[model samples]
Target: MSATEQPVHDHSTAALDHGRRGSLGQIVSWCLWDFGSNAYNTVILSFVFSVYVTTAAAPDEQTGQQVFANMQTVAGIIVALLAPVIGVWADRVRRRRLMLSVSTLLVVASVSMCWFVLPYETHHGLKYLYLGAGLIALANMMQQVAEIFYNSMLVDISTPSNVGRISGAAWGLGYLGGVITLAATLALFVLDGGFLGVPEQDAMNYRAIAVFCAGWLLVMSVPVMIWGPPAPPAKGDARTLNVVSAYAQVFRHLRRKFRTSPQVLGFLVASAVYRDGLSAVFAFAGVIAATSYGMDTTEIIIFGLAANFAAALGAWVFGLVDDRVGPRFVILASLATMVVFGGLILAISATAMFWIGGLGISSLVGPVQSASRTLLTRVIEPGEENEMFGLYNTVGRAASWIAPGLIGIFTALLGTRLGLLGIVLTLLGGLILFWFVRIEGVTHNRSRVTSAA
Candidate 1:
């Protein structure tokens, strides 16, 4: 342990009593939550439902895209405001499971409601578009809020020696789930009206997919709810904090952390910056492929599937490396490599080069994400896990506009391909910031305690 690192406390509550750190069942159950969550993250939010809302539900393509973007911006602001307060409440009452359950169910409900968003050709109104947008935005927000509790659980399920690989496995599972779900969607619904032969008259295929996503999430959520450890006993009463009080408490916590452990805050900010860059890389890679490489929609989808596979593979491999070495080393190496790959994609115009560079950057991204989560889990003090993760999400959403904004500016000034420089710059900036983040060592078997998952 580092000289400045404080001793971590162990919780002996029945809900947290884990034999052998955490059983394989417990760990696998935790990972399945990620797999199930891909229904929302991959299908509804990223690929299928969003595309339907923008292109079919709305009156026109431009209007649909604009309205959906605005709704997401609003959702992002609300999440930033609410995440910390919810985290604080969950920790105070020791009701992480209850909170997680409520949020997850809410997400399910929101996604299921997406079934009502009929295409304009069938419904002939703006209401459907607005309804679809609203439901998706709600689902997105609740999903993120659910993640606060979900991420806090990571500490409970793994030891310091294995947290890296566990986190990596979970992330890899999510990417794999996304790939499978997306491919299934294409094969079963979107391609040639699908083999199911669900009539295309009113866009029933997409609506059915929404219902499927809801069921997928609900069913997938059951394992963790049943087998996962319950929250530990509260330290005190469960008085809830209002918005003002919650923000005040969060600020006070940040101030104290800054004074006592500046690296905590440093990692939060640094990870937020680079994470945004990672998101942009995934978001814009399709755009580059279409515009620069002249890849058609079918080709783009195939590339996306391949990219997810690469990311999944990288997460699994680097996760083992993380356990042997440390998350800091994994994160630094991944981010540095990503910066170089992003530059290569920007500089090279060949189709083969785009495939190589795009997949290279994609592979690096999952490791960085997994390593970042692992590092945060290791660094936080014993009891403040939920609140710290809430801050992690908030800071991340707060800076969410950087990469997109930079991409917009650079694209306007230069061209489409050169706009990728913004992504490279954002990543380089994060790498520099992360270089200064010190991971205080902890005694693996002594002070580090089994927490939540």
Candidate 2:
């Protein structure tokens, strides 16, 4: 292969696939992991635990926002520092699943501990504030790291003919899980006084939900461990390396990619910019609804359900289209839709905006995210999959602070509603760069070659 071209490496052998077509049970198991993992996404970050930490636990509104942003900033920094190194290590050791399992266990443990983050009037310390936010931060980092490993498994269960559908199915499962889990939260916690008559005092209602979210993740996340494609030994060249060597290897890998496969570099940078924006959109969705759109807790929960449903449907439908028309189109279209919807939401300030524009914006979120993953898989080879996915998470998290950081800065200067413009800007950046990307090697020939082989 020439520089700027990807070599066709056999992906069939890695990440639980054992070089065979994956079974339905295995596919479902893999997707279910997304389902379970999203418990952390929906409950802790987007809606319940974070809302509790910021609004209920913090001293004031501004401090709450600052604290939430800072917590994520620190977590992003930690993830950025560790993701590539750990990914390098996992690839070397051929222990991606072990790494994922341990990371997931940490998420469960940390989320459950959020139960103790009782409100201020009931308990008198910044201890809960720090503790809750800290756990949320840790969980955020751990979950992200886990996803790097999880994402590597995509090739294990996919074929070029069906990769889009497989990825879309998994993405759909994630949103569907959020839909079901969030609805369960509404049924179990938000509607009633919550389990065991947990007093609304001290934010106990939210505290109980934290415990529930942990349990939810625990149950949803375990199936993949049991049923995912059996991980084979890492590629023959996969050698164990120390941390220093691991990073060295990563540097060499990046150097090779930048020179020989500039497309990879371009995709990485573009993905980093837009994915940060995508993360921010979901991260602050509930808050925006509550504050800007005047969505009550009940309404926010309902909106989350509607948004998840829309996202799940969009991902599934667009995924099939992704296979035929290509992920590039899907991504561009999704970004364009998001830019338009996000701008409209910024300009308009009413419940109608959230209901229409908010849902429209949420619909685009999944296709962009799912297509992004699918696009990356279409670009890279096998042995380096784990490392690349790690870099994916690394670069993404490296800039993770950007959207939230910009939002924090702008919100402080202007106002909450205006701060949302940051997301639009980041998306625009990614969309612009994405336009130049040319998928030369993998997308056109890999499927035919793999089928022939």
Candidate 3:
């Protein structure tokens, strides 16, 4: 066997003897990490705390928006520059568990900082907001890195035939986790008073939500660390280096890797454009609804729950399509839907119209996006999956600045309504570019060999 080839064993017989040890259980545990982690993104970062920082926490809404955008932009820059390097390190060390553990701790610590956010009256509130944002950005970087490794583990657990199912199941479970967390948070603070006589101040409730999310993340990650086996270390020089040297080596490696296959580079470029647009849909959706359509925090939370539920359903349904059809077709279809319905959202102004148009378009977003991910999985070589996903993360982070920057720019120039028009245009452009990606025959031989085995 070549150095890159994983040992082929008739584990199918062993699995049958031991009641068919399916990847489903491990996949579920892996997904639970996303579920727990995204609680921060949905409840704290995107929805509740973002509103708090912008509306109440900042000097004003304009300043809040600038600060928020700036923080994200800076983080994206750092992640874009560092991701490929760290991805190479991950591949060399095969130490995904260690990386995951370190990153999770950082997330927990950063989230716990929410407890220190004073009420809006104090000057320290703004300082706390900036500090928290910085930490959150750092934590998010770590989370992204860990996800590169975690996603790579999918190859270890499932066959090519079941990869889509496994990926879809993980994504669905994560969304379900988000739905539950959001619901619990809303019930605890918004709908009812805080647990056991706690006050119902927005800041206080948000703090509790952060703490809950942190605890949830730490706890849920335990199972995967315990049960999922580690990959063997790469058989090359594995010495660690300072960040500067690390980055230099990564750049050198990236040049070499890209030269080896231009298709990989093309995939990254196309994925970056569309993925950024997709992320923007989640990041700014609440803000658009709240500022433009007068939706309250509670309403935003409800919408988020609805969106997550739809996303979960989409992932499951699309998983089958991914296996039977192809990931590229799924992505093209989703992007087209986004362009059409997204335009309707840009045209509408009233809150009722917003909800009607938004939800109508949102229904198609989840399934197509999930299938796009499965498509990436289909293209990469197994041993290189982690590094490629790391590149995926890098491209995503690099492109992250575009949509948010566009949103900020357009909102300032044209108004929130027209800002959405810019977003729709971005999605349409991404769809057009994504369609040109040739995926039908790229990995057919490798897939055939695996299936035949």
Best by lDDT: 1
- For model 3, state the Cα shift of residue 176 in Å: 1.2
CA lDDT scores, all candidates in order: 0.82, 0.80, 0.69
Candidate 1: where is the Cα deviation over 4 Å?
Answer: 1-20, 442-453
Q: Cα deviation in Å at residue 290, candidate 3?
A: 1.4
RMSD of 2: 3.2
Per-residue lDDT over 1-453 for candidate 1, one digit per residue giving the tens place of the 0 to 100 score: 999877543322222223326678888988998988987877787656887888899889889978888898999999998889988877777888778888999999999999888998778888898899999999999999989999988888887668888999999998898788878878887788887777787898988889888998898888887787676666766677777887888889999887767767888999999999998887777767776678875687688888888998999999998877777788889999988887887777777888898889889888999988887877766667789899999999998999988988998899888888889999999999989876445213322333332
Give TM per candidate.
0.91, 0.91, 0.87
Report the C-alpha displacement of residue 153, candidate 2, in angstroms: 0.8
lDDT per residue for candidate 3 within 391-430, as digits (tens), equals 8888777677667668778998998776776667677767
lDDT of 3 at 253: 55
> How big is the positional error of residue 246 in model 3, measured in Å on the Cα after superposition?
4.4
Q: Model 2 — TM-score against the truth?
A: 0.91
| C-alpha RMSD by candidate, in order | 4.3, 3.2, 5.4
Q: After superposition, how far is residue 102 of candidate 2 from its true place, in Å?
A: 1.4
Off by over 4 Å in 2: 1-19, 236-239, 412-414, 441-453
